[model samples]
Target chain A: MKAFETYHPIVLFAYFASVIGLSMFYMHPVYLLITCIGAITLNLLLNRKSFISGLKFFLPMFFIAAIINPLISHDGEIILFYIDYNPITLEAIVYGFAMSIMICSVIFWFGCYNVVMTSDKFLYLFGKVSPALALVISLTLRLVPRFKHQITVISHAQKTIGMDISAGNPWQRVKSGIRIISILITWALENAIETADSMKARGYGLKNRSTFSLFVFEKRDGFLLGIILTLLFINILGSYFGVTTYYFYPTFTELTVTPISIGLYISYASLLVIPIVIEIREAIKWRSLKYNM
Target chain B: MQAQSTARADIYSRKRLIFSSIIIFVVIPIIMLIGVTIFNDRKYNLISMIIVLLACVPFFVSFERRKPQAREILTIAVMSAISVAGRAAFIWIPAFKPVTAITAITGFAFGAEAGFLTGATSAIASNIFFGQGPWTPFQMFTWGILGFIAGLLGQKGWMKSKIALIIYGVFAGIMYSFCMDIWTVISYDGLFSWKRYLIAMSTAIPFTIVYVISNVVFLLVLAKPIGEKLERIKVKYGMLNN
Candidate 1:
């Protein structure tokens, strides 16, 4: 089994949560790029199906996110050239490149999150803190799949009534579309009410209503989680001394290398790839097992 | 006597909204604009977004503190859920989203606070399906601001006509693009640039137009039916009377 995927839900949740939280909170380009590369690589490896599909929309967005920076953010020194007296600087382009990389990586990581943290995992993590919030998230997740199904059913019913949107004028087409929406709204609300009623009848919201869950916290999970926490601790401590800090605006800072900083970087890199290493180990075992069989 | 008391309460809440709206919509952005300009720092941008969200959320609670919260909460949640679902449902209409119109209508029917939460919730909840990024905060801010404004205009009877509502929708679409454009620029350059902002604005004109057109279309279609039903709920349940 893939050790990362099969870890205790809490470990996986903590791993993803810490990764996303840290990535967003940091503005350091070097650290961010390292994490970005790690995130993208892991995402593509673990969630290839969604990676390919999302690339269709996400690919263009990545370029747009990067290029738009140099266009609108005119900060930094080291002028590359002048576009009518307003200089287009190397710094801005580099900042754009880094920011875009960070953005794409965060998005890719989120996609990986969706693949890894199913509704059950999220509910398991958050159910006790606030059941209402958990319910809303789970309900919203369910809504997408059912919504697609209902649309086809509604469209077919409309076709039978000879009010086909495809055959109509622009105004009529919009009217028909609105009519379909109106119908869906009524049905959806009624459905929501029924769900609320059913939930209430089941003794939901009772303080003593205990949950049944199959998730178990194993020893291996605890060991991995300990390692993850240690890496995070060192990284945060190192950040105060500006380990990954690289200034771009006004002027670019000369890159520095030191032993402690190297240690910090190595820890951070290992933290990012812990799951990947686990994944590779599992794949190699599978290959060896297949040959033996 | 009953009518006069209700009128007085209405006046008080409207006054509170105007004050809070100024803080959320005007004061904070100015602070961010000046903070970044003077400090010449990128860290401030990140902190400012947090400040923007934290500062506005308390005001939302203040507006609803004395009101019946259950109905308001349920309504906001349901409407946000609807808007999020709608965003995912209509994938063919690129750049056009019913989420903004639905958020605007929620603000019109409920108060600005309700509108804000609905919009914010719509953004976060939809991103569950659409995928989240650094842009999540920006999306929440823009949509919440749109709802907040719609509520203010509704309170002032400015949204009286269908035409006015449609105009608001169109303006909101442009505002969304502009705000998102600001985010893009800041995210790219690590700071804002007026010249580059203008160029980015021009390039985004086509997308903005599509957004405006979609807002108009969705509002025209959904406002009457949804707004009326919500109005009926407000009266029937006598909910959110504060």
Candidate 2:
């Protein structure tokens, strides 16, 4: 893990929320290309093994999302072909491809988010703002993997008793699975009840209780957050004011590279590449230290 | 087996729900549409979406405050977790989902309001494991509606039959794909076009069929035991008296 990974969880979450928000809120093709490359690269850098494995899921999603646009959108400037008496346009196809990349890359970023935003980080981020809802959401996010593990254990135990879901005929197996689930539901409710009672006994939600957290916002984190927000604000302002606008409708507009847009582009790129830059800097420092050693 | 004591407490909740549903599902879109007509700008769609998502906060706040017992709140959380996990369990099966079945049952046992919250919550929560995007809010609303219908209609005489549940599953499957297809159509064309929507629907029929099969399969497998357990919990705890 890089030094960036060890920052206060709130800093990390704010970075993600801002970055992902940019991906969704900004539709400029240039901005999108930068986002696509940055998200995928950072993701691969984070974990190459998982990134490759995720290709099996992301490729199809990209293609489907990309292809569907040209199929339905016939209002583009460059008509490519006619399918079922409707015109398919090159502009639409290109727009669709951009959109798909936008979606897939955001998904890649979220895949990274899943890795970095552990349950503790998630709880800390929301706990201060909305305690009750945060507590519930953290519990739910935490429970999912636990529930999956429970399913495996239950299925294993059932198999030992000759009541495996995979063993019986289809209907009988389904029935058997439900029987297992019946046991699981009882367990789940009882488990939740016990948790609730435990919290109650601990004086939760009864008064203003002070809690301690491990994360403290350092000056480095302050700088990081300030830079991210400043760039994000500038980029959002550019788009919101239509300074970075492009048309893909009845007529496609040329993708102009004006000075202002170029600045916006730089801000957006720098915003996304912050993590990569940090990693590269750390790598150079480590190499220099080794040479000195 | 729902108790009589809670009905008076919940009547206000039901009233507020109906009012908010109209406001969320009907009035907001109409306002956006009117704005579009006045300005001749379709960008109002984003404004409308943001407004509706914000409205969810108040709705949830009401759910939190009026929630009679801590048990029901935890129950909803656990059910949402189960639905998310169930979706993850079927990761190998593309487009197949047990979410609808479970969400539908949550509606059936709980009232329409709880049903909507469960469906919506499950969608958002599961997307954390799957993916979240512009599609998240739409998925939340659509699945919430499906659950509301199941709760509103599923508890009655014929609707309670297994055959009817299967039929509802099939319809729900199509409805989900169709609802999502609107996002496809609008995002593709920048406006809701009938021709585009039709093509989108036709293109997605295969996925819809999988939804049908998966919903039926999972519902058949899940509803009875989960439903039975939920009902027993409700009666034993005197929950959701309305």
Candidate 3:
């Protein structure tokens, strides 16, 4: 496991929640830069190949999202040009760019989140809040792979009967597809009954049913949680004080660099940099230990 | 046995009615008020997400309170997993997914709460494969509401007719796109703009038509067989009858 992911699920969840939330709400260019860099860097550290490949999808989306606003919105003082008679304004373009960046940063953070918060971690976290629903989610997650396997089995069996989905006319193919799903439904539902019977046999839904999990909260987790909460509190305070709010409509506000605003920027940066720092530290520690060996 | 089961149904529907009323009447308004006043109409994505999550809480709380049987929970799991797998089965066809049909069928057989759970759970579970995004909550809420409404309408006799099913299929398609587009418009500016939303909707018309067609086709084709199968399972396993 990576160093950051090794922390308690609570800490990881909180960190992603706060970072993604802040990324969505804060349109300040500086804050966006910090978050975008942090998210990209963290993603690169965690999964470099996938992060680079994701850009192929995100790049077009980013440009489309950024381009659409100016075409539709004509709500600024500085008019750029007429597009088929409607004036596109500087403010609209700027707002579009900012919103696009915000959207991209949030998506990137989620990429990082997806990497760090595996389904097991997510289910573990969710299990604390709603155990029954969590179990339902867990069971569904488990069943998806099994169902896929069963689909293959069922399809092969059906193929032998000349009802092959891939080798039929268009209409026949559609019929075969539906038939496969139909047969799968009957098979799954019938099998589910036996699964439930086994569960009942094993004393499911009993009182005070204890769930076994591997996660345990250590002192380091508490300390990391403390740091995250503190930084998050600072960022929220900064937002509440209107320091993080940037205006792109009507007229652009002059970028101000007050001490308090600077402090808020640093705090936000530090918050995002926590995981990157931890990963780097871990890498360095492992390198030194390897050298000693 | 019949009288007792009817009594149980009465209690179940009553609890659901109370919860829905509280959410629709009180909770949603208060949330809108807060969203408008405090958020100044920004953060529509976040605010609506919170609202969606809040709307689902009552259903789950009641489900938990009822001490749901293993088979009951397994039924929901099985239905949700099927919907997720259904998406995979139809992966070749872009914009054609049987998730809504399966979820709606589950609601038709099981009840609104099970339908809602199936819709919401499948949304998240499928995202594990497709990748989760800011739109996950919106998708969950949209599909869940589709199932929820399907369950309510399924309780009536007329929803079994072909015309009613067609109407519902079109409605579910439009509703899914409509709900999903709110996030699209909001994601652009962190607030809602009618002009931008109109543009987004106009551009999305082709996809929406596909959704409507696919939903109708799937519902008409899959509804009878799957609904019958689900009913048989419920009867055989005595699932969710409480």
**Residue by residue across A127-233, what tens digits does model 1's lDDT show?**
65545445555666666567667867897899899767787799888778777877776666556555655666787555587878889888898998998888887
lDDT of 3 at B37: 70
Off by over 4 Å in 3: A166-168, B1-13, B19-41
Query: Cα deviation in Å at residue A245, candidate 1?
Result: 2.1
TM-score, every prediction: 0.80, 0.83, 0.95
Worst-scoring 10-residue span by lDDT in model 2 chain B: B38-47
Interface DockQ of each model: 0.24, 0.39, 0.69
Interface RMSD (Å), every candidate: 4.7, 3.5, 1.6
lDDT per model, in order? 0.74, 0.77, 0.86
Q: Which residues of candidate 1, in runs, are more than 4 Å off?
A: A8-10, A24-33, A52-96, A123-130, A166-170, A204-206, A212-221, A249-251, A287-293, B1-41, B44-49, B52-74, B155-157, B234-242
What is the CAPRI rating of model 3's predicted complex?
Answer: medium
Q: What TM-score would candidate 1 get against the native?
A: 0.80
Native contacts retained by candidate 3? 0.68
TM-score of chain B of 1: 0.82
Model 2 over residues A111-177: C-alpha lDDT tens digits? 7777777667777876776566666666678788878788788889888888889876898897778
Q: In angstroms, what RMSD does candidate 3 have relative to the true structure?
A: 2.0
